[model samples]
Structure formats: C-alpha cells, structure tokens
Target: MTAKEPSVFRQGFKDGLPIGIGYFSVAFSFGIAAVSSGISWWQAVLISFTNLTSSGQFAGIGLIASFASYIEMALTEFVINMRYTLMGISLSQKLSPAFKMPFKLTLGHCNTDEIFAVAMSRQGEVSPAYMGGLSILPYVGWTGGTLAGAVLGNILPFSLSQALGIMIYGMFMAIIIPAARRERPVLFVVLTSVIISCIIYFVPAFSFITSGFSIIICAVAASALAAWLHPVEGEVADET
Candidate 1:
C-alpha cells in the first residue's frame, strides 16, 4: 500500500467526523421513537444497526406497531429507499478501479446522503481505504446513538420519551424547508405529498389504506407528478 493511500483514508475519516456527529442526534430521536412504538430496546438498536436509514426505519417501526402486513412493509421500504439505488449508481462512477466488488458492497450499505455528498465532492476517484474510513465513524455513531436512546426511552417518563421522538420530525422539516425554498419543483412535490398524505389520513373512504401503503402512494404520486411537470431536458448538472 502506498503511503499516500493512508493519508487519503485519514482525510476521508476527518471529513466524515462532522457527519457522524450530526447523525448521532438524529438517530437518538429514532431510537426513542422506535421504542415508544412498542418494540424492545434491543430490537430498535438492531434495526438501526442494520438499516442505517432514518425515514425508512421510522416508517418500518410504525408499520410494525400497527401490525401492517409484510408486503406492505416491504413495498413501503422499497419505495422510500429507492433513491439509494440511484446514489449507489452515481457513486460508482467516482470509485477507483481498484475498489473491488466486496468493498463496494460494504460501502454501499452505509452510503447515506451526507456520506455520498462528501465522497462525490472529492477531486478524483475514491479509493477503497478512503471509502472504508469514511463509513466507519458514521456507522458507529448511528448505532451507538440508537442504543443510548433506546435504553433511555425505557427509563424516561412516557411524556418525555414522546417529546424526544418529535426531534426526528423537526429534522425532516429542517431538511425539506431549505430545499423547498430553493427549488420550485421541490416545493411543488412537497406540497403534493403533504396534501395526498393528509387526504389518506383524514378521509373515511381512504381509511382502508394502511400507513405503509399510504406512504408509498404519497411518495410515488407526488414524485411522478413533479417529474411529469418539470422533466429535466438534458443531462442534469451535478449539484455537488
């Protein structure tokens, strides 16, 4: 291994540190939410460790709590996490030729939005050692925060635990509000999703739709409408 490779790995690790810190706070809220939804603390931690997806995991726990069907859960997760497939494809272009399939598969599992953005911003092809270093701390932070929050949820007052769970929603809003303000298409899609979700939640006729299915429908319908209305005309510019 070249000495330069170790330096590159260290740089990646340093770049990922802040992301790891941010993930801890968000994952804490998820942990609380998961446990409050009637799952055991260990189960919540296990989900966080394996899934590494905030929105999908939260939705999955909600489905589990409501006794939703397996198919519903599977489809809901698939729809919500479909973006990751695109992200993986994009990141593949940035990978060094020496980054083998096994390492690529491992890195793909933890390729969250922040991690992907950081990696893509780099000047050249990403090496396996760099990707490995980039992934480690965030993975640890997410799982460790889940364990902490899950244990605390079991001990904290029910009211306090519930309040902590609201943090996750606030985090989502913080992410959406900025993007929606910057892009008209994003705002339109957000509004469409919200309207459809509310209709599914409040209308008596739509009560047959399970929470998982409702999420899938809202996301797909909103995204489809947005894409149809504002289709990209050419190769999309990299925002990174």
Candidate 2:
C-alpha cells in the first residue's frame, strides 16, 4: 500500500484492476455452477480460493458431482490445467534476476491467465513486487465473486440459475472468438476440438469413457493436430 516503495507495484495493481473486475462475472458463474454441482457454499468458496482456475475448477466440480474416483479427478485436473505449467516456465524467463526462488514460488501460486498476460506484456524483467501487486486484487475479486455467487445460489430460483449458467460459456466465447477470428489455426483447432468432443459424446462406443477423459482426448488430439498443421514461428509464438 506504500506508494513510495516502488512505482512498478502500483502500475501493476492499476493494470490488474480491470482484469479483477472482469473476473467477477466469470467467477460468479463458476460459483453458481459449483454449488449446483452439489458442493456447499463454503466448499465452493474454498475451491475458488484454493484452485484459482475457471475451466479446471468447473471440470473438477463436474467430476465431483458425477462421483468420479480420486484418480480420475486428479488425472482430469492435470490434463486440463497442464497449460499453467507451460505458462509458468515461460514466465520464469521474464522475472528479474533479484527475484529468488521463494518469490517465484509465492507468485507462482497466483499466476492466473490475466496475471501472466499482463506480466508478459511488460517491457522489462518482471519484479516480484509488481507481480505481488498484480495478483492480489484479482485473487480477491475471483474469490469474493465466488463467495457472493455461492450465497446467491442458495436463494436463486432454478430457472434463473440455469440462465446464469450460460455466462461461463459466454465468457469463454468472448475470449476465443476474438483470437479465433484473427487466427486460422486457432479457429481450426477450435472446430476440430468441438467435432471430436461431439463425436465422443454422441457415439455409443465412447460411452465407456467419462466426460473428463473425453475432454482430455479431444484437447490433446486437437492441439497435436494444430501444432503439426501450423507450427508456430518464433515471432508468432511471441505474439501469442
């Protein structure tokens, strides 16, 4: 909170504020979804706080509601959230030399998509103070929004809750639609994934595999195909 300490921290907080505000709606949907999936309100809040992931947490809730075994849940989470590991590795190269392992470890826990993007967009090496400031607000917003939605879920009618459920997909579309419009490979990958997922869902033969495994299969297949078809150039990778 001390402005005299460093301008980078303040700048990071300022930049992160918008992402925090945006997180409210998404996390709100997640909260509603989690509660509807049979977890208690406090449990929903706890999941949001601890997991700090949108799609992964939603997928986990689905698995939990379906009574998936622990191994299945773990594997699904690992598959779905494996991108964070890549993000962390990419981010490590951008950190300031003064940023030690402890700082990296601390910041790693809160490095969600928005935070990573903002940090990577910076011109110079990322400072621990800035990352700290950047992460705090969004963390609060995501967790707070989940808490609010969980409380509201108890009072909201079934019809209204169902309507609110679409917000999660809407948020996803808002993210992918822009990039997919610009990038043919992204669009192709998305379509491929959707087709694969549909085939898995509708085909009786794939009925033995759970939805969780189906998603993993679709994602892996689509990503591998996309990588093969459109290997990213260094410049393109930087842009991405």
Candidate 3:
C-alpha cells in the first residue's frame, strides 16, 4: 500500500523472471525425459501442470516408465515432497495477518527452494500477493517448457540432447553449491541424503523405486529433526 512497499513487490517481480528462466531449462528436460520414456506430449504438459516439483515429476515419470502401480507412485511422491510442508510453515510467519490464509493455501503449491528463499528473505509486513505474483510467471514458464520439450524431443540430435540433460543437473549443483556453503544444516541434509541413496541402490528391498526417493526420505527426516532441535525463529515482531 505504501510507496516503499510497492518497490519490494516490484523487486519480487523482477527477480522472478531470472528464477523462472532457470526453472524453464530444468522443466524442459523433464518434459523430454517424460516423452522419451513413452508419455505423450499432452500428458507431459499435464504432469507439469499438476505437479511443479522436479523431484516429484521425475519420480512419477519413473513409476510410469516401469509401469509401477498407482500406490507406489503416490507414496513415492508424498514422502519426497514432505519438505513443502515445512516450507509452508516458515512462509506463514512472514505473511501479513490478513494475507496469511491465502498465502498459506496457494503458495504451498509453488513452494520450491528458490521461491522459498525469496519469501524468507523479506523483512516486514510482506504481502502474500507479492509471493503469488512472483511465482505465477515461473510456474507458467516451467509448464510451457515441458510441453515444448516433449514436442521437440525427437527432432533434436542425440548427443546434443544428452548434453542438455546433463546441463540441468549442473544448474542444480549451482543452486546447491551456494546454499551448501553457508547452511550447515542443508549441507548435512544433502550429504546424508546422498549416502542413504547409495545404500538404497545397493540394498535389495529398499530399491523398490528408482525414482530416487532416498534423498527425499533423508531430507524430510533430517529437516524434521533439525527443525525440532532448532525451532524456526519466528517473525521479528515476536521478538519485540
């Protein structure tokens, strides 16, 4: 409402563009992966529309590829995506009292690490609209990229496609490298997750799903334990 406040909202909009661009490349890869694995282009689009998460979508693709049962796919995604629950809780404290309900309800749907970091960095009576406004463009870009990639997958050269696929993971590493440097808890979570994942690969019964639920399980468990030990610091006003 204040002149100063609109500036923050505008900043969110501007920042969201680059963030959206980053996700588009990754989501585009998911689209190609889905289509190559036998899912139709429309189906790939729908998947991106319904689930914006890279992990969840990738897990679903694996389940679809292996012809896994619905129960298996649902359970895999549920356990992995449990991190969003914690993300929503943290974002709630940042919202203005009046905007709390709306933000709590909708933003949870779009709560990936990038957007979560954007929301958490704010300092005052942050508006939920700012969060929603920023997130929408990227969500569209991701979904659109997926559809485009699925349609274009076969037309591209094999080697080039392979390179592009690897690039997305490199982008992920770039995202991780920064946070892993400063956040001991995040570093621990990622490292522990990787170790557990290796165990899952080598172990028999635990290897039920290759959609990579190991990292999800480790992250949720580790983050839950961390949150319990170091309860999230509440809004600054609570301190005053």
In lDDT terms, how accurate is model 2? 0.80
lDDT tens readout by residue for model 1, 1-240:
567898988988998787677677678878888888999999999998899888899889999999999998888898777767767877987778778889877877888877877787677677888888888888888898888888865575767656655654664575678878988998999999999999999999999886656776887799889989998444343322
State the RMSD for candidate 3.
3.8
Q: Give the TM-score of candidate 1.
A: 0.68
Error of 1 at 35 (Å): 0.7
Top TM-score hit:
3
Q: How far does residue 5 in candidate 2 sit from its true spot (Å)? A: 4.8
* Candidate 1: 10-residue stretch with minimal lDDT: 231-240
Per-residue error (Å), model 1, residue 42: 0.7
Residue 187 error, candidate 2, Å: 12
**Candidate 3 Cα outliers beyond 4 Å, as residue runs:** 2-5, 122-126, 166-213, 220-240
lDDT of 1: 0.81
TM-score of each: 0.68, 0.69, 0.74
In candidate 2, stretches whose alpha carbon ends up further than 4 angstroms from where it belongs are 1-5, 154-240
